[model samples]
Target: MPAQSWKLISHFWGLKAPHFESQFVIVASSFSSFLYLGACYGYFAKRERNKIGKIQS
Candidate 1:
């Protein structure tokens, strides 16, 4: 019985996996880009703050 269920599950995935994979790729790339941009912004902002502090002292 378990084997039969596993076969059914695999068959369903075989039909649908490509569509889900494409969606996952699109989502993952967008997420990574956002993460990279946020890191760059934070780094630049910290550097700018340090420069301001130096000018004040």
Candidate 2:
């Protein structure tokens, strides 16, 4: 194996390894936040249904 090939392999693995953890955490948090907001909006809208404006047919 050439020196360049070894360096390329190491750098590729290094870049990918940390991203797995960070990406999972970021994505999970964002999805949870979105779900929380959606639930809150759904609950509020359900309770305030009469107060909200009606749509025309």
Top candidate on TM-score is: 1
TM-scores for all predictions: 0.65, 0.55
> Considering summed lDDT, which 10 consecutive residues are worst modelled in model 2?
48-57
Across 1-57, the per-residue lDDT of candidate 2 in tens digits comes to 344554565566557768676566555555666788889999998867755544321
| Pairs in clash, predicted candidate 2 | none
33, model 1: CA deviation in Å?
A: 0.8
Q: In the order shown, what is each candidate's alpha-carbon RMSD? A: 11.4, 13.3
Q: How many backbone clashes does candidate 1 have?
A: 0
Each candidate: how many clashes? Answer: 0, 0
Q: Which structure among the candidates has the greatest lDDT? A: 1
TM-score between candidate 1 and the true structure: 0.65
Candidate 1 overall Cα lDDT vs. reference? 0.70
Candidate 2's displacement at residue 9, Å, is 30
